[model samples]
Each structure stands twice: as structure tokens, then as C-alpha cells.
Target chain A: DTAVSQTPKYLVTQMGNDKSIKCEQNLGHDTMYWYKQDSKKFLKIMFSYNNKELIINETVPNRFSPKSPDKAHLNLHINSLELGDSAVYFCASSQAFTGIGEAFFGQGTRLTVV
Target chain B: SQQGEEDPQALSIQEGENATMNCSYKTSINNLQWYRQNSGRGLVHLILIRSNEREKHSGRLRVTLDTSKKSSSLLITASRAADTASYFCATGGGTSGSRLTFGEGTQLTVNP
Candidate 1:
């Protein structure tokens, strides 16, 4: 079984459009995160949730919103996506809010904004 | 701002050779972790070393952490073409307390 999975491995949409990427983890982890990887392969954390509570929200644009219905699932929704949003999105999960544990990551969703 | 910075942005080596990548961080950390990502794939956890620990080994991968210098290195022994991927060093636990920040990965290409 896939420990962590994200839907729509590839996404292509025009600018100003709205899109959502869903992520789920079956590792029974309490903390989930959303990361953005740019063309240069720089990974930046966007949001983090622990036990369905928002814990860390980086300086990401307000257009990006993360929703966690349960501890095992965290989804990202983008409103009025811009061209600069074209990048790969990764979902990860850890056993706890502490960063000492290893994280399991999803295959990643490559979003291309035209 | 990234907490960690990896040296030698890219490295190319022939199969059976060893590959080494270094990472330096700005702040104190509770632990350091290394991850590998193949093209078009997500980052996979390779190994992790705590602040109290100095070295860790997992199969062909060796990780060393120096908290005093706030740096770490990952060494791959007898690398294979299949091991070609981008390696990233991440530092965890700082002022934010819960952030796991990653460095700009080092692209390693092991040619056969």
C-alpha cells in the first residue's frame, strides 16, 4: 500500500483558473505538510498541519489554501492561480509535529500554469 | 530563506566510484536528515542523524553531522547509475520549533 498518495500527478491549467490537489496518507501520521519545488529543485514548505490543526503556515500567497479534514488527509486548493504557481507540489507526513522523525512523501503533483 | 545550503550544486561520477555531498546550515538544529529524489519523483528519506549523534550508516549511504559547525555530509559508496538522483539535506528544529527546512539539493549523476 502506498504510504502517502496525491491525486493528479500532472496538472495543466490556464492562469487565473482554480484547482485543487488532494493528498492522503495511511501511515497513521499526525503531521502533514505541503511543499513546493521550483524548477531549480528548491523545496519550500507551504503549510503544515498536525492532528487536523494548522501549525505552520509559511509566507505563501493567500491564494494557496490547505485543508485537512482529518489527520490522514490534507488537501491544497488554489484560487486564481497565477503563472508563477507553475511548479511541482509535494505532500508529506510525519509521525509527529516534531521534526525529528523521517517524513513520507507522495509522488508529487506537477502543476503547469499556462 | 533556506536554512541549509549544499555545496557543489551538482556532481557527476562514474559507476563504482564514491560520491560525497556537503551541507551547511545557519542555525542550531535538533536533527539533520538526508533525502534523495529521482527525476519526477518525490523525496525519499535516506537517513537521519540527531544533534547528539555524529555519524549514521544505512547500507551504502553514510551520513555525518557536526552540530558545532552546523554542517553535514552524505557519502555514497560504490555508487551505481541507479543511484543517480538529487540529494537534499534538511535541518529540523529551530526557532520555529517545528519546521524542517531543506537545502538546495545536489544533483548527482552516476554514469555507467
Candidate 2:
């Protein structure tokens, strides 16, 4: 069984189009995160949810919104997507919100906005 | 802002040789972790060393943490072609809302 899984492994859309990426984890973790890796392979944290509650919201643009219906699922919705948003997004889960443990990551979703 | 910065942005080594990567962080952390990502894949957790721990060993991977210097190092012994990938060092804890801060990553290529 895949410990962490995200849907739409690849996404291609035009600028100004809205899209969403769904993520789910079966690792029984309490904390989940969304990260973006750019062309230079620099990874940055976007959002974090713990037990379905928003815990960490970075300096991300207002277009990107994350919703966690429950502890197992966290989805990212981007409105008015722009060319700068093109990157690989990864969903990961850890044991707790302390962030002291190792995390499990999904295969990642490669988003391309032309 | 990124908290960790990895040294030697890229490294190329022959099979059976040892590969070493170092990481330096800006702030104090409760723990540090090493992750590996293959081309077109997500990051995979490799090893983690806590602030109180000096070193840890897992299989052929060895991790050392120095809180005093705010740095860490990962050593891969007998590296193989399969080990060729981008290795990242991430720092956890601090006032950053429990988010793990990742470095730029080190691209390691092992020639067969």
C-alpha cells in the first residue's frame, strides 16, 4: 500500500486557469505539508495542516489555498495560476506537528502553466 | 527563506567510493534529516539525527549532527550507481511553525 498518494501526477494548464491537486496519506500521521520545488530543485514549504487545522501558512501568494477536510486528506487549490507557479508540488506527512520525525512523501505533482 | 545550505552543490564519484555531503543551518533546530530524490520523483527520507544525538548509523548511511556549529553531515559508504540522486538536508524545529526547512540539495552522480 502506498503510504502517501497524490492525484494528478502531472498537470498542464494555461495561465489564469484554476486547478487543484488532491493528497491523501495512510501513514496515520497528525501533520501534513505541501512543498514546492522549482526548476533549480529548491524546495520550499507552502502550507502545513495538523489534525485538519491550519498550522503553518508561509508567505505564499493568495492564489494558493489549502483545505484539509480531515486528517487523512489535504488538497491544494490555486486560483488564477501564473507562469511562476509552474513547479513540482509534493505532499508529505509526519508523525506530529513538532516536526522532529521523518516524513513520508508522495510521488509529487508536476504542474506546468503555459 | 531557506535555513540550511548544502556545500558542494554537485559531486561525481565512482562506484564503491564513499560520498560525503555537508549541511549548515542558520538557526537552532531540534533535529536534522537527510532526504534523497531521484529524477522526477518526490523526496525520500533517508536518515535523521536529533539535537542531542551526535551520530547515527543506518545501513550504509551515516549521519552526524553538531548543534554547536549548527551543521550536519551525511556519509554514504560504498556508494553505487543506484545511490546517484539529489540529496537534501532539512532542518526541523525552531519558530518556523514546525515546518522542515530544506537546503538547495547536492546532486551526486555515481559512475558505474
Candidate 3:
């Protein structure tokens, strides 16, 4: 079974369109995260949720919002996506909120905004 | 701002050779983790070395951490073409609740 899975493996949208990506983890992890990989392959943590509660929020713009309905699911919604939003987004989960545990990552969703 | 910076932004090696990548971080960390990302796949956890530990080994992957220098190195022995991928070193600690700060990855190309 896939420990972590995200939908819409590839997404292409217009400049002003809005889109949402869904992520789910079956590892029974307590913390889930969203990371953005830019064209340079630099991975940056955008948001993190611990047991359905928002814990870490980076310097991301307000256009991107992460919602965790439960401990197993974390979804990302982007409002008015722009050209700069064209990048790969990955979903990850860890057994605990600490870094001692390894994180399981899902296949990334590549977003291309025209 | 990125917390870690990987040395030798890109590397090319023939199969059966060894690949070494270095990582330097800006702050104190509880632990350092290395991850690999294939051409179109998500990043996979390779190995981790704690701040107090000096070196660790997992199969052909060897990781070394130097807290005093705030630096780390990942060595992959007998690298194969399948090992071609971007390697990233991430530092986890600080007041952000175990949040990981990643470095710009090092792209390794293992040619057969």
C-alpha cells in the first residue's frame, strides 16, 4: 500500500485560475506537511499540520492555504494562481512532530500555470 | 532563506564509481537528514545523522555530521545509473517544532 498519496499528479491551469490538491496518508502519522520545489529544485516547507492543527507556516503568500480535516489528510488550495506558482508540490507525513522520525513523501504534483 | 547549502551543485560520474556530496548549514540543528529525488518522483529519505553523532552508515550510503562546523557529507559507494538523482540535505531543529529546512539539491548523474 502506498503510505502517502496525492491526487492530480499533473496540473495545468491559467494564470488566474484556482486549484486544489488533495493529499492522504495511511501511515497513521501525526504530522503532515506541504513542500514546494521550484525550478531550481530547491525544496521549501510551506506549511505543516500536527494532528489537524496548523503548526508551521512559512513565508508563503496568503494565496496558498492548507487545510487538514483530520490526522490522515492535508489538502492545499491556491487562490488565483500565478505564473510563479508553476512548480512541483509534494505532500509528506511523519510519525511524530519531531525530526527524529523519517517522513514519508507522496509522488509530487507538478503544477504549470500559464 | 535556505538554511543549508549543498556543495558542487551538480556532479557527473560513471557507474560503479563513488559520489560524495557535502552540506553546510547556518544554524544549530538537532539532526541532519539526506533525501534523494529521482527525475519525476518525490524525495526519498536516505539516512540521518544526529547532531551529537559523527558518522552513520546504511548499506552503501555513508553519512557524516560535524556539529562544530555545522556541516555534513553524504557518500554513496558503487553508484549505479539508477542512483542518478538530486540529493538534498535538510536540517531539522530550531523553535519551529521540528520543521525541516532544505538546501538547494545536488544533481548527480551516474552514467552507465
Q: What is the lDDT of residue B32 in candidate 3?
A: 92
Give per-residue CA lDDT, model 3, range A29-112, as digits (tens).
Answer: 999999999998999999999999998899999999999999999999999999999999999999858754688899999999
> How would the docking of model 2 be graded?
medium
Better of 2 and 3 by DockQ: 2
Write candidate 1's Cα lDDT for A30-83 as tens digits.
999999999999999999999999998999999999999999999999999899
- How well is each residue in B14-109 modelled by candidate 1, as lDDT tens digits? 999999999999888888999999999999999989889999999999999988888999999999999999999998875547878999989999
Candidate 3: which stretches are off by over 4 Å?
A: none
List the candidates' TM-scores in order: 0.98, 0.98, 0.97
Measured with C-alpha atoms, the lDDT of residue B51 in candidate 2 is 86
| Deviation of model 3 at A8, angstroms | 0.6
- Which 10-residue window of candidate 3 chain A scores lowest in summed lDDT? A95-104
Q: Which is better, 2 or 3, measured by TM-score?
A: 2
Query: What are the per-model numbers of colliding residue pairs?
Result: 0, 0, 0
What range of 10 consecutive residues in model 2 chain A has the weakest lDDT sum?
Answer: A95-104
Clashing pairs in 2: none
Model 2 Cα displacement at A1 (Å)? 0.7
> Going through the candidates in order, what is chain B's TM-score?
0.97, 0.97, 0.96
lDDT of each structure?
A: 0.93, 0.94, 0.92
Cα lDDT of model 3 by residue, B1-112, tens digit: 7899998899999999999999999887888999999999998999978888999999999999998888999999999999999999998875335788899989999999
